[model samples]
Target chain A: MQVELQLFATLRKYAPDQPLDKGLVMNVEPPLTVSILLEKAGVPLDKVKIIMVNNRHAGFDQELAAGDRVAAFPPVAGG
Target chain B: MTERYARQLNLPHWTPETQQHLAAARVLVVGAGGLGSAVLPYLVAAGIGLTGIVEDDRVDLTNLQRQVLYDTQDIGVPKAEAASRRLAALNPDVEIRSHRTRLEPGNAAAILAGYDLVVDCTDNSAARELLNRTCLNLEKPWIHAAVSEYFGQVTTLLPGGPCWQCLSGTGAPADPPPAGILGPVAGLIGSVQATEALKQLTGTGRLLVERLLVWDALLPGWAEFSYRRNPDCWACGRG
Candidate 1:
Protein backbone atom coordinates (compact mmCIF):
# COMPACT_ATOMS: atom_id res chain seq x y z
CA MET A 1 0.00 0.00 0.00
CA GLN A 2 1.14 3.55 -0.70
CA VAL A 3 0.28 6.49 1.59
CA GLU A 4 0.94 10.24 1.37
CA LEU A 5 2.81 11.63 4.38
CA GLN A 6 2.54 15.31 5.34
CA LEU A 7 4.65 16.79 8.08
CA PHE A 8 3.86 20.33 9.22
CA ALA A 9 5.71 23.11 11.08
CA THR A 10 8.98 21.89 12.57
CA LEU A 11 8.19 18.41 11.45
CA ARG A 12 8.61 19.43 7.82
CA LYS A 13 12.36 19.50 8.25
CA TYR A 14 12.28 15.71 8.58
CA ALA A 15 10.74 15.21 5.13
CA PRO A 16 12.71 17.98 3.44
CA ASP A 17 12.59 16.22 0.12
CA GLN A 18 8.78 16.13 0.04
CA PRO A 19 6.96 18.80 -1.93
CA LEU A 20 5.01 21.38 0.02
CA ASP A 21 1.37 20.50 0.73
CA LYS A 22 1.57 17.64 -1.79
CA GLY A 23 3.26 15.33 0.75
CA LEU A 24 5.51 12.32 0.24
CA VAL A 25 4.42 9.02 -1.19
CA MET A 26 5.67 6.05 0.83
CA ASN A 27 5.17 2.35 0.06
CA VAL A 28 4.24 0.69 3.32
CA GLU A 29 3.08 -2.73 4.45
CA PRO A 30 -0.53 -3.36 5.42
CA PRO A 31 -1.79 -2.94 9.02
CA LEU A 32 0.26 0.30 9.25
CA THR A 33 -0.78 2.70 12.02
CA VAL A 34 -0.21 6.48 12.40
CA SER A 35 2.62 6.00 14.93
CA ILE A 36 4.49 3.60 12.72
CA LEU A 37 3.98 5.87 9.74
CA LEU A 38 5.50 8.83 11.58
CA GLU A 39 8.40 6.66 12.73
CA LYS A 40 8.97 5.59 9.14
CA ALA A 41 9.05 9.24 8.03
CA GLY A 42 11.67 9.98 10.73
CA VAL A 43 9.23 12.36 12.48
CA PRO A 44 9.76 12.27 16.21
CA LEU A 45 6.72 11.00 18.11
CA ASP A 46 7.24 13.45 21.00
CA LYS A 47 6.87 16.51 18.75
CA VAL A 48 3.59 15.38 17.25
CA LYS A 49 0.56 17.33 18.48
CA ILE A 50 -2.29 16.37 16.14
CA ILE A 51 -2.54 13.53 13.70
CA MET A 52 -5.09 13.16 10.92
CA VAL A 53 -5.71 10.88 7.98
CA ASN A 54 -7.53 12.54 5.08
CA ASN A 55 -8.47 15.49 7.28
CA ARG A 56 -10.33 13.87 10.17
CA HIS A 57 -9.06 13.80 13.75
CA ALA A 58 -7.26 10.46 14.20
CA GLY A 59 -5.32 8.44 16.75
CA PHE A 60 -1.79 7.14 16.59
CA ASP A 61 -2.91 3.53 16.69
CA GLN A 62 -5.58 3.93 14.00
CA GLU A 63 -5.07 1.60 11.05
CA LEU A 64 -4.17 3.12 7.70
CA ALA A 65 -5.46 2.18 4.27
CA ALA A 66 -3.88 2.69 0.87
CA GLY A 67 -3.95 6.28 -0.43
CA ASP A 68 -4.37 7.71 3.08
CA ARG A 69 -3.20 11.32 3.31
CA VAL A 70 -1.58 11.44 6.73
CA ALA A 71 -0.71 14.79 8.34
CA ALA A 72 1.04 15.59 11.60
CA PHE A 73 1.11 18.98 13.30
CA PRO A 74 2.95 20.41 16.25
CA PRO A 75 1.12 22.43 18.89
CA VAL A 76 0.70 25.90 17.27
CA ALA A 77 -0.26 28.16 20.19
CA GLY A 78 1.01 31.65 19.44
CA GLY A 79 -0.76 34.81 18.38
CA MET B 1 -16.37 59.14 2.96
CA THR B 2 -20.15 59.29 2.57
CA GLU B 3 -20.32 55.54 1.85
CA ARG B 4 -17.95 54.08 4.39
CA TYR B 5 -18.82 50.48 3.50
CA ALA B 6 -19.40 51.00 -0.18
CA ARG B 7 -16.81 48.37 -1.07
CA GLN B 8 -18.01 45.49 1.13
CA LEU B 9 -21.63 46.32 0.38
CA ASN B 10 -20.87 45.89 -3.29
CA LEU B 11 -20.04 42.24 -2.78
CA PRO B 12 -22.60 39.88 -4.34
CA HIS B 13 -24.44 38.90 -1.15
CA TRP B 14 -23.73 41.99 0.94
CA THR B 15 -26.69 44.25 1.61
CA PRO B 16 -27.80 47.10 3.79
CA GLU B 17 -29.36 44.53 6.12
CA THR B 18 -26.02 42.83 6.56
CA GLN B 19 -24.44 46.19 7.26
CA GLN B 20 -27.09 46.84 9.87
CA HIS B 21 -26.34 43.58 11.62
CA LEU B 22 -22.66 44.53 11.67
CA ALA B 23 -23.49 47.95 13.11
CA ALA B 24 -25.45 46.37 15.95
CA ALA B 25 -22.91 43.68 16.84
CA ARG B 26 -20.65 43.85 19.88
CA VAL B 27 -17.29 42.08 19.83
CA LEU B 28 -14.62 41.47 22.47
CA VAL B 29 -11.00 40.99 21.44
CA VAL B 30 -8.78 39.32 24.01
CA GLY B 31 -5.08 40.16 23.83
CA ALA B 32 -4.03 43.29 21.96
CA GLY B 33 -0.89 41.73 20.56
CA GLY B 34 0.07 40.57 17.08
CA LEU B 35 -3.25 39.01 16.13
CA GLY B 36 -5.23 41.61 18.04
CA SER B 37 -3.42 44.33 16.16
CA ALA B 38 -4.63 42.78 12.94
CA VAL B 39 -8.21 42.04 14.12
CA LEU B 40 -9.16 45.25 15.98
CA PRO B 41 -8.57 47.72 13.15
CA TYR B 42 -10.69 45.68 10.73
CA LEU B 43 -13.55 45.32 13.20
CA VAL B 44 -13.48 49.00 14.03
CA ALA B 45 -13.15 50.14 10.45
CA ALA B 46 -15.89 47.79 9.29
CA GLY B 47 -18.21 49.68 11.66
CA ILE B 48 -18.93 47.12 14.35
CA GLY B 49 -20.97 48.93 17.01
CA LEU B 50 -18.88 48.19 20.10
CA THR B 51 -15.40 46.72 20.23
CA GLY B 52 -13.91 45.85 23.62
CA ILE B 53 -10.21 45.14 24.06
CA VAL B 54 -8.71 43.05 26.87
CA GLU B 55 -4.96 43.54 27.08
CA ASP B 56 -3.04 44.05 30.31
CA ASP B 57 0.56 44.27 29.19
CA ARG B 58 2.38 47.40 28.23
CA VAL B 59 3.75 47.52 24.71
CA ASP B 60 7.43 46.72 24.36
CA LEU B 61 9.81 47.72 21.59
CA THR B 62 9.89 44.14 20.39
CA ASN B 63 6.18 44.01 19.61
CA LEU B 64 6.30 46.72 16.95
CA GLN B 65 7.32 44.13 14.35
CA ARG B 66 3.89 42.49 14.31
CA GLN B 67 1.76 44.46 16.78
CA VAL B 68 1.30 47.23 14.21
CA LEU B 69 -1.30 48.99 16.38
CA TYR B 70 1.51 50.42 18.48
CA ASP B 71 4.43 52.71 17.63
CA THR B 72 7.85 53.76 18.96
CA GLN B 73 6.67 56.43 21.41
CA ASP B 74 3.74 54.23 22.39
CA ILE B 75 5.93 51.38 23.65
CA GLY B 76 5.48 52.13 27.35
CA VAL B 77 1.74 52.63 27.02
CA PRO B 78 -0.75 49.85 27.69
CA LYS B 79 -1.66 47.87 24.57
CA ALA B 80 -5.38 48.26 25.19
CA GLU B 81 -5.00 52.03 25.47
CA ALA B 82 -2.65 52.34 22.54
CA ALA B 83 -4.72 50.11 20.30
CA SER B 84 -7.93 51.84 21.29
CA ARG B 85 -6.50 55.24 20.43
CA ARG B 86 -5.39 54.06 16.99
CA LEU B 87 -8.65 52.27 16.28
CA ALA B 88 -10.62 55.31 17.33
CA ALA B 89 -8.75 57.41 14.80
CA LEU B 90 -9.34 54.87 12.07
CA ASN B 91 -13.09 55.32 12.51
CA PRO B 92 -14.52 57.60 15.14
CA ASP B 93 -18.09 56.47 14.44
CA VAL B 94 -17.64 53.22 16.35
CA GLU B 95 -17.31 52.62 20.10
CA ILE B 96 -13.98 51.21 21.28
CA ARG B 97 -13.58 50.10 24.88
CA SER B 98 -10.22 49.24 26.36
CA HIS B 99 -9.89 46.88 29.31
CA ARG B 100 -6.33 47.20 30.48
CA THR B 101 -6.18 43.85 32.22
CA ARG B 102 -5.68 40.22 31.39
CA LEU B 103 -8.75 38.00 31.10
CA GLU B 104 -8.68 35.66 34.05
CA PRO B 105 -11.15 33.44 35.91
CA GLY B 106 -11.86 36.31 38.23
CA ASN B 107 -12.81 38.69 35.40
CA ALA B 108 -13.52 36.53 32.34
CA ALA B 109 -17.24 36.06 32.91
CA ALA B 110 -18.00 39.68 33.65
CA ILE B 111 -15.99 40.94 30.69
CA LEU B 112 -17.22 38.36 28.18
CA ALA B 113 -20.87 38.74 29.21
CA GLY B 114 -21.18 42.16 27.61
CA TYR B 115 -20.23 41.09 24.11
CA ASP B 116 -22.01 38.93 21.55
CA LEU B 117 -18.77 37.26 20.48
CA VAL B 118 -15.10 36.97 21.46
CA VAL B 119 -11.90 36.80 19.40
CA ASP B 120 -9.02 34.80 20.83
CA CYS B 121 -5.78 36.56 19.86
CA THR B 122 -4.06 35.74 23.13
CA ASP B 123 -0.69 33.97 22.98
CA ASN B 124 -0.68 32.09 26.27
CA SER B 125 -2.31 28.81 27.20
CA ALA B 126 -4.16 30.29 30.17
CA ALA B 127 -5.97 32.94 28.10
CA ARG B 128 -7.00 30.38 25.48
CA GLU B 129 -8.31 27.95 28.11
CA LEU B 130 -10.10 30.69 30.04
CA LEU B 131 -11.73 32.09 26.90
CA ASN B 132 -12.73 28.63 25.73
CA ARG B 133 -14.45 27.61 28.99
CA THR B 134 -15.94 31.03 29.71
CA CYS B 135 -17.41 31.35 26.23
CA LEU B 136 -18.95 27.92 26.70
CA ASN B 137 -20.60 28.90 29.98
CA LEU B 138 -21.69 32.28 28.63
CA GLU B 139 -23.07 30.75 25.44
CA LYS B 140 -21.14 32.99 23.06
CA PRO B 141 -19.47 32.21 19.75
CA TRP B 142 -15.78 32.95 19.21
CA ILE B 143 -13.07 32.81 16.56
CA HIS B 144 -9.77 31.21 17.56
CA ALA B 145 -6.40 31.91 15.86
CA ALA B 146 -2.82 31.14 16.80
CA VAL B 147 0.56 31.56 15.12
CA SER B 148 4.23 30.61 15.38
CA GLU B 149 6.98 31.12 12.82
CA TYR B 150 5.48 30.54 9.38
CA PHE B 151 2.56 28.44 10.60
CA GLY B 152 -0.87 29.37 11.98
CA GLN B 153 -4.34 27.92 12.55
CA VAL B 154 -7.82 29.43 12.77
CA THR B 155 -11.18 27.99 13.80
CA THR B 156 -14.63 29.08 14.76
CA LEU B 157 -16.17 27.64 17.91
CA LEU B 158 -19.93 27.89 18.01
CA PRO B 159 -22.45 26.91 20.68
CA GLY B 160 -22.89 23.33 19.39
CA GLY B 161 -19.54 22.62 17.73
CA PRO B 162 -16.50 20.96 19.21
CA CYS B 163 -15.16 22.91 22.17
CA TRP B 164 -11.50 23.74 22.50
CA GLN B 165 -10.83 20.73 24.72
CA CYS B 166 -12.04 18.34 22.09
CA LEU B 167 -9.67 19.72 19.47
CA SER B 168 -6.82 20.68 21.73
CA GLY B 169 -6.47 17.68 24.04
CA THR B 170 -3.59 19.71 25.45
CA GLY B 171 -4.45 23.35 26.10
CA ALA B 172 -1.56 24.29 23.79
CA PRO B 173 1.66 23.01 22.40
CA ALA B 174 3.78 21.44 25.13
CA ASP B 175 6.57 23.91 24.33
CA PRO B 176 6.73 27.39 25.76
CA PRO B 177 5.54 30.46 23.86
CA PRO B 178 7.29 30.63 20.48
CA ALA B 179 9.44 33.75 20.54
CA GLY B 180 9.72 34.08 16.79
CA ILE B 181 6.82 34.97 14.50
CA LEU B 182 6.93 36.14 10.91
CA GLY B 183 4.94 39.33 11.09
CA PRO B 184 2.88 38.47 8.03
CA VAL B 185 2.03 35.05 9.43
CA ALA B 186 0.35 36.70 12.41
CA GLY B 187 -1.33 39.18 10.11
CA LEU B 188 -2.65 36.46 7.83
CA ILE B 189 -4.17 34.42 10.63
CA GLY B 190 -5.63 37.48 12.31
CA SER B 191 -7.19 38.56 9.03
CA VAL B 192 -9.06 35.26 8.99
CA GLN B 193 -10.24 35.92 12.55
CA ALA B 194 -11.54 39.33 11.59
CA THR B 195 -13.28 37.89 8.53
CA GLU B 196 -14.86 35.15 10.63
CA ALA B 197 -16.08 37.75 13.12
CA LEU B 198 -17.81 39.72 10.39
CA LYS B 199 -19.45 36.61 8.99
CA GLN B 200 -20.65 35.50 12.40
CA LEU B 201 -22.28 38.88 12.97
CA THR B 202 -23.85 39.42 9.56
CA GLY B 203 -24.59 35.76 8.68
CA THR B 204 -23.10 36.50 5.27
CA GLY B 205 -20.82 33.55 4.59
CA ARG B 206 -20.37 29.89 5.45
CA LEU B 207 -18.66 30.08 8.81
CA LEU B 208 -15.59 27.93 9.53
CA VAL B 209 -17.50 25.92 12.08
CA GLU B 210 -16.07 22.57 13.25
CA ARG B 211 -13.00 23.00 11.07
CA LEU B 212 -9.40 23.60 12.03
CA LEU B 213 -7.83 25.59 9.18
CA VAL B 214 -4.07 25.28 9.21
CA TRP B 215 -1.57 27.15 7.03
CA ASP B 216 2.18 27.05 6.80
CA ALA B 217 3.89 29.76 4.77
CA LEU B 218 6.68 27.43 3.87
CA LEU B 219 4.26 25.05 2.23
CA PRO B 220 2.31 28.13 1.20
CA GLY B 221 -1.08 26.44 1.22
CA TRP B 222 -3.99 25.72 3.56
CA ALA B 223 -5.21 22.38 4.91
CA GLU B 224 -8.24 22.03 7.12
CA PHE B 225 -9.66 19.04 8.97
CA SER B 226 -13.25 18.76 10.07
CA TYR B 227 -14.05 17.74 13.64
CA ARG B 228 -17.32 17.07 15.42
CA ARG B 229 -18.60 17.78 18.90
CA ASN B 230 -16.81 15.37 21.21
CA PRO B 231 -19.53 13.82 23.35
CA ASP B 232 -16.84 13.33 25.98
CA CYS B 233 -15.56 16.88 25.70
CA TRP B 234 -14.81 18.20 29.15
CA ALA B 235 -16.69 21.41 28.43
CA CYS B 236 -19.43 20.72 25.85
CA GLY B 237 -19.43 16.95 25.68
CA ARG B 238 -22.53 14.94 26.53
CA GLY B 239 -20.60 12.56 28.70
Candidate 2:
Protein backbone atom coordinates (compact mmCIF):
# COMPACT_ATOMS: atom_id res chain seq x y z
CA MET A 1 0.00 0.00 0.00
CA GLN A 2 1.20 3.51 -0.82
CA VAL A 3 0.29 6.59 1.23
CA GLU A 4 1.04 10.26 0.47
CA LEU A 5 2.67 12.18 3.33
CA GLN A 6 2.46 15.98 3.56
CA LEU A 7 4.14 18.07 6.20
CA PHE A 8 3.80 21.72 7.17
CA ALA A 9 5.83 24.28 9.13
CA THR A 10 8.84 22.78 10.93
CA LEU A 11 7.58 19.35 10.06
CA ARG A 12 8.50 20.10 6.46
CA LYS A 13 12.08 19.36 7.42
CA TYR A 14 11.06 15.73 7.76
CA ALA A 15 9.93 15.45 4.12
CA PRO A 16 12.23 13.25 2.03
CA ASP A 17 13.83 15.76 -0.38
CA GLN A 18 10.53 16.48 -2.08
CA PRO A 19 8.11 19.39 -2.30
CA LEU A 20 6.53 19.53 1.13
CA ASP A 21 3.09 20.35 -0.22
CA LYS A 22 3.32 17.89 -3.05
CA GLY A 23 4.15 15.29 -0.43
CA LEU A 24 6.14 12.08 -0.58
CA VAL A 25 4.76 8.70 -1.50
CA MET A 26 5.68 5.87 0.87
CA ASN A 27 4.93 2.18 0.52
CA VAL A 28 3.99 0.29 3.66
CA GLU A 29 2.32 -2.95 4.64
CA PRO A 30 -1.36 -3.11 5.55
CA PRO A 31 -2.71 -2.21 9.02
CA LEU A 32 -0.55 0.93 9.20
CA THR A 33 -1.28 3.31 12.09
CA VAL A 34 -0.47 7.06 12.09
CA SER A 35 2.10 6.58 14.84
CA ILE A 36 3.81 3.78 12.93
CA LEU A 37 3.94 5.85 9.75
CA LEU A 38 5.38 8.86 11.60
CA GLU A 39 8.06 6.61 13.11
CA LYS A 40 8.90 5.14 9.73
CA ALA A 41 9.21 8.60 8.19
CA GLY A 42 11.55 9.64 11.03
CA VAL A 43 9.17 12.39 12.21
CA PRO A 44 9.28 12.40 15.99
CA LEU A 45 5.85 11.79 17.42
CA ASP A 46 6.42 14.81 19.70
CA LYS A 47 7.09 17.00 16.67
CA VAL A 48 3.66 16.48 15.17
CA LYS A 49 0.98 18.34 17.10
CA ILE A 50 -1.69 18.12 14.44
CA ILE A 51 -2.58 15.24 12.15
CA MET A 52 -4.98 15.40 9.22
CA VAL A 53 -5.97 12.33 7.31
CA ASN A 54 -7.80 13.13 4.10
CA ASN A 55 -8.08 16.68 5.52
CA ARG A 56 -9.85 15.50 8.65
CA HIS A 57 -8.33 15.36 12.11
CA ALA A 58 -7.19 11.89 13.11
CA GLY A 59 -5.66 10.42 16.23
CA PHE A 60 -2.27 8.74 16.45
CA ASP A 61 -3.82 5.28 16.74
CA GLN A 62 -6.08 5.81 13.73
CA GLU A 63 -5.63 3.17 11.05
CA LEU A 64 -4.51 4.21 7.57
CA ALA A 65 -5.82 2.58 4.41
CA ALA A 66 -4.08 2.36 1.07
CA GLY A 67 -3.52 5.66 -0.76
CA ASP A 68 -4.38 7.76 2.31
CA ARG A 69 -3.35 11.39 2.30
CA VAL A 70 -1.78 12.36 5.59
CA ALA A 71 -0.75 15.87 6.61
CA ALA A 72 1.27 16.56 9.71
CA PHE A 73 1.95 19.99 11.21
CA PRO A 74 4.12 21.02 14.09
CA PRO A 75 2.82 23.59 16.54
CA VAL A 76 3.46 27.11 15.25
CA ALA A 77 4.05 29.53 18.13
CA GLY A 78 4.44 32.95 16.61
CA GLY A 79 2.06 35.79 15.76
CA MET B 1 -23.75 56.47 9.88
CA THR B 2 -21.38 59.35 9.61
CA GLU B 3 -19.51 60.83 6.66
CA ARG B 4 -16.44 58.90 7.83
CA TYR B 5 -17.94 55.56 6.75
CA ALA B 6 -19.47 56.95 3.57
CA ARG B 7 -17.18 54.93 1.29
CA GLN B 8 -17.92 51.61 2.98
CA LEU B 9 -21.64 52.41 3.06
CA ASN B 10 -21.56 52.82 -0.70
CA LEU B 11 -20.68 49.13 -1.06
CA PRO B 12 -23.53 46.82 -2.01
CA HIS B 13 -23.46 44.78 1.18
CA TRP B 14 -22.80 47.55 3.66
CA THR B 15 -25.66 49.95 4.14
CA PRO B 16 -26.46 52.42 6.90
CA GLU B 17 -28.07 49.53 8.77
CA THR B 18 -24.91 47.38 8.59
CA GLN B 19 -22.92 50.39 9.73
CA GLN B 20 -25.26 50.68 12.68
CA HIS B 21 -24.81 47.00 13.43
CA LEU B 22 -21.06 47.48 13.44
CA ALA B 23 -21.38 50.40 15.80
CA ALA B 24 -23.32 48.22 18.25
CA ALA B 25 -20.93 45.25 18.21
CA ARG B 26 -18.17 44.68 20.75
CA VAL B 27 -15.12 42.52 20.04
CA LEU B 28 -12.04 41.34 21.93
CA VAL B 29 -8.76 40.83 20.12
CA VAL B 30 -6.33 38.66 22.15
CA GLY B 31 -2.84 39.65 21.11
CA ALA B 32 -1.23 42.91 20.16
CA GLY B 33 1.44 41.43 17.95
CA GLY B 34 1.61 40.84 14.21
CA LEU B 35 -1.94 39.74 13.50
CA GLY B 36 -3.48 42.20 15.97
CA SER B 37 -1.59 45.06 14.33
CA ALA B 38 -3.49 44.35 11.13
CA VAL B 39 -6.74 43.25 12.79
CA LEU B 40 -7.11 46.27 15.10
CA PRO B 41 -7.00 49.12 12.60
CA TYR B 42 -9.54 47.51 10.30
CA LEU B 43 -11.94 46.69 13.12
CA VAL B 44 -11.68 50.24 14.48
CA ALA B 45 -12.01 51.85 11.08
CA ALA B 46 -15.10 49.74 10.41
CA GLY B 47 -16.65 51.11 13.63
CA ILE B 48 -16.93 48.27 16.10
CA GLY B 49 -18.52 49.97 19.13
CA LEU B 50 -15.98 48.69 21.65
CA THR B 51 -12.69 46.89 20.96
CA GLY B 52 -10.67 45.35 23.77
CA ILE B 53 -7.01 44.55 23.24
CA VAL B 54 -5.36 42.12 25.64
CA GLU B 55 -1.59 41.93 25.58
CA ASP B 56 1.12 41.88 28.19
CA ASP B 57 4.35 42.17 26.22
CA ARG B 58 6.24 45.40 25.89
CA VAL B 59 7.26 46.39 22.40
CA ASP B 60 10.78 45.33 21.47
CA LEU B 61 13.02 46.37 18.59
CA THR B 62 12.43 42.94 17.10
CA ASN B 63 8.68 43.47 16.89
CA LEU B 64 8.65 46.30 14.32
CA GLN B 65 9.13 43.87 11.42
CA ARG B 66 5.48 42.74 11.57
CA GLN B 67 3.78 44.21 14.63
CA VAL B 68 2.83 47.27 12.62
CA LEU B 69 0.78 48.73 15.43
CA TYR B 70 4.00 49.90 17.09
CA ASP B 71 6.93 51.97 15.98
CA THR B 72 10.57 52.42 17.04
CA GLN B 73 9.40 55.07 19.48
CA ASP B 74 7.06 52.50 20.98
CA ILE B 75 9.94 50.15 21.77
CA GLY B 76 9.78 49.69 25.58
CA VAL B 77 6.15 50.73 25.87
CA PRO B 78 3.48 48.18 26.62
CA LYS B 79 1.96 46.88 23.37
CA ALA B 80 -1.65 47.09 24.51
CA GLU B 81 -1.26 50.74 25.48
CA ALA B 82 0.66 51.61 22.34
CA ALA B 83 -1.89 49.89 20.15
CA SER B 84 -4.80 51.52 21.96
CA ARG B 85 -3.35 54.98 21.50
CA ARG B 86 -2.67 54.40 17.84
CA LEU B 87 -6.03 52.81 17.10
CA ALA B 88 -7.88 55.56 18.96
CA ALA B 89 -6.16 58.19 16.87
CA LEU B 90 -7.23 56.30 13.75
CA ASN B 91 -10.88 56.48 14.76
CA PRO B 92 -12.05 58.28 17.89
CA ASP B 93 -15.64 57.26 17.23
CA VAL B 94 -14.63 53.71 18.10
CA GLU B 95 -13.82 53.03 21.75
CA ILE B 96 -10.59 51.13 22.45
CA ARG B 97 -9.71 49.51 25.76
CA SER B 98 -6.28 48.14 26.55
CA HIS B 99 -5.97 45.27 29.00
CA ARG B 100 -2.23 45.05 29.47
CA THR B 101 -2.03 41.52 30.86
CA ARG B 102 -1.33 38.01 29.64
CA LEU B 103 -4.45 35.90 29.20
CA GLU B 104 -4.51 32.69 31.19
CA PRO B 105 -7.21 30.26 32.27
CA GLY B 106 -7.75 32.10 35.57
CA ASN B 107 -8.42 35.48 33.91
CA ALA B 108 -9.52 34.45 30.44
CA ALA B 109 -13.22 34.13 31.23
CA ALA B 110 -13.58 37.50 32.97
CA ILE B 111 -11.63 39.27 30.24
CA LEU B 112 -13.70 37.64 27.51
CA ALA B 113 -17.19 37.57 29.03
CA GLY B 114 -18.72 40.80 27.71
CA TYR B 115 -17.53 40.80 24.14
CA ASP B 116 -19.90 39.59 21.44
CA LEU B 117 -16.98 38.03 19.56
CA VAL B 118 -13.26 37.32 19.90
CA VAL B 119 -10.30 37.18 17.53
CA ASP B 120 -7.58 34.75 18.62
CA CYS B 121 -4.47 36.49 17.41
CA THR B 122 -2.17 35.01 20.03
CA ASP B 123 1.11 33.49 18.86
CA ASN B 124 1.31 30.46 21.12
CA SER B 125 -0.78 27.32 21.33
CA ALA B 126 -1.52 27.65 25.06
CA ALA B 127 -3.16 31.01 24.58
CA ARG B 128 -5.12 29.74 21.60
CA GLU B 129 -6.35 26.76 23.57
CA LEU B 130 -7.32 28.98 26.50
CA LEU B 131 -9.29 31.28 24.20
CA ASN B 132 -11.03 28.29 22.63
CA ARG B 133 -12.15 26.89 25.98
CA THR B 134 -13.21 30.29 27.30
CA CYS B 135 -15.17 31.16 24.17
CA LEU B 136 -16.80 27.76 24.11
CA ASN B 137 -17.80 28.14 27.73
CA LEU B 138 -19.15 31.63 27.08
CA GLU B 139 -20.89 30.54 23.90
CA LYS B 140 -19.18 33.36 21.96
CA PRO B 141 -17.96 33.00 18.43
CA TRP B 142 -14.27 33.61 17.75
CA ILE B 143 -12.01 33.60 14.70
CA HIS B 144 -8.59 31.89 14.89
CA ALA B 145 -5.62 32.78 12.68
CA ALA B 146 -2.01 31.61 12.79
CA VAL B 147 0.97 32.50 10.63
CA SER B 148 4.28 30.68 10.31
CA GLU B 149 6.79 31.93 7.76
CA TYR B 150 4.82 32.23 4.51
CA PHE B 151 2.05 29.90 5.60
CA GLY B 152 -1.15 30.92 7.34
CA GLN B 153 -4.42 29.36 8.50
CA VAL B 154 -7.75 30.85 9.54
CA THR B 155 -10.91 29.28 10.94
CA THR B 156 -13.97 30.34 12.86
CA LEU B 157 -15.20 28.45 15.92
CA LEU B 158 -18.81 29.13 16.78
CA PRO B 159 -20.59 27.76 19.78
CA GLY B 160 -21.37 24.06 19.39
CA GLY B 161 -19.23 23.91 16.26
CA PRO B 162 -15.81 22.46 15.49
CA CYS B 163 -13.13 24.13 17.61
CA TRP B 164 -9.36 24.42 17.94
CA GLN B 165 -9.27 21.34 20.14
CA CYS B 166 -11.22 19.43 17.53
CA LEU B 167 -8.52 20.34 15.04
CA SER B 168 -5.34 20.13 17.16
CA GLY B 169 -6.56 18.27 20.22
CA THR B 170 -6.02 19.37 23.86
CA GLY B 171 -2.36 18.69 24.53
CA ALA B 172 0.22 21.44 23.98
CA PRO B 173 3.42 20.36 22.35
CA ALA B 174 6.74 21.22 23.98
CA ASP B 175 8.26 24.37 22.54
CA PRO B 176 8.91 23.59 18.93
CA PRO B 177 11.33 25.50 16.71
CA PRO B 178 10.77 29.26 16.52
CA ALA B 179 8.38 30.34 13.77
CA GLY B 180 9.49 32.54 10.89
CA ILE B 181 6.74 34.88 9.73
CA LEU B 182 6.74 37.46 6.96
CA GLY B 183 5.03 40.79 7.58
CA PRO B 184 2.58 40.55 4.72
CA VAL B 185 1.57 37.05 5.71
CA ALA B 186 0.44 38.35 9.08
CA GLY B 187 -1.28 41.24 7.37
CA LEU B 188 -3.09 38.92 5.00
CA ILE B 189 -4.35 36.56 7.71
CA GLY B 190 -5.17 39.45 10.02
CA SER B 191 -7.21 41.17 7.33
CA VAL B 192 -9.09 37.92 6.76
CA GLN B 193 -9.79 37.74 10.50
CA ALA B 194 -11.10 41.31 10.49
CA THR B 195 -13.31 40.48 7.53
CA GLU B 196 -14.66 37.39 9.31
CA ALA B 197 -15.40 39.51 12.39
CA LEU B 198 -17.35 42.06 10.37
CA LYS B 199 -19.37 39.36 8.63
CA GLN B 200 -20.05 37.59 11.90
CA LEU B 201 -21.16 40.79 13.56
CA THR B 202 -23.33 42.14 10.71
CA GLY B 203 -24.81 38.72 9.93
CA THR B 204 -23.72 39.03 6.29
CA GLY B 205 -22.08 36.63 3.88
CA ARG B 206 -20.71 33.14 4.51
CA LEU B 207 -18.68 32.49 7.65
CA LEU B 208 -15.61 30.21 7.73
CA VAL B 209 -17.24 28.15 10.45
CA GLU B 210 -16.08 24.49 10.40
CA ARG B 211 -13.71 25.25 7.57
CA LEU B 212 -9.96 25.82 7.82
CA LEU B 213 -8.50 28.04 5.10
CA VAL B 214 -4.79 27.47 4.63
CA TRP B 215 -2.70 29.86 2.55
CA ASP B 216 0.78 29.12 1.37
CA ALA B 217 2.62 32.01 -0.20
CA LEU B 218 5.02 29.66 -1.91
CA LEU B 219 2.11 27.85 -3.48
CA PRO B 220 0.50 31.29 -3.79
CA GLY B 221 -2.89 29.76 -3.33
CA TRP B 222 -5.51 28.84 -0.77
CA ALA B 223 -6.74 25.38 0.16
CA GLU B 224 -9.76 25.15 2.39
CA PHE B 225 -10.50 21.92 4.23
CA SER B 226 -13.62 21.22 6.22
CA TYR B 227 -13.45 19.75 9.73
CA ARG B 228 -16.16 18.21 11.86
CA ARG B 229 -16.75 18.47 15.58
CA ASN B 230 -14.91 15.64 17.33
CA PRO B 231 -17.27 13.78 19.60
CA ASP B 232 -14.36 13.31 21.99
CA CYS B 233 -13.00 16.81 21.65
CA TRP B 234 -12.13 18.21 25.03
CA ALA B 235 -13.40 21.66 24.12
CA CYS B 236 -16.65 21.05 22.22
CA GLY B 237 -17.42 17.37 22.38
CA ARG B 238 -20.66 15.54 23.15
CA GLY B 239 -18.86 13.55 25.84
Tens digits of lDDT, candidate 1, A1-79: 9999988777777988999758999999988999899899998787787787899987788899999999888777788
Clashes of each: 1, 1
> Against the true structure, what is every candidate's RMSD?
1.9, 1.9
Best by DockQ: 2
| Per-residue alpha-carbon lDDT of candidate 2 for residues B42-78, written as tens digits (9 for 90 to 100) | 9999999999999999999988999998989999999
Q: What is the DockQ of each candidate?
A: 0.56, 0.57
TM-score of 1: 0.94
User: What tens digits encode model 1's per-residue C-alpha lDDT throughout B1-239?
Assistant: 33998998888888888888888899999988899989999999999999999988999999999988899999798888888889999999989998988898999999999999999999976778889899999989999998888889999999867887787762234765565899989999999999999988988779999899988898788889987777877767754
Relative to the unseen true structure, what is the C-alpha lDDT of residue B11 in candidate 1, on a scale of 0 to 100? 88
Per-prediction TM-score, chain A only? Answer: 0.94, 0.93
lDDT: worst 10-residue window of model 2 chain B: B169-178
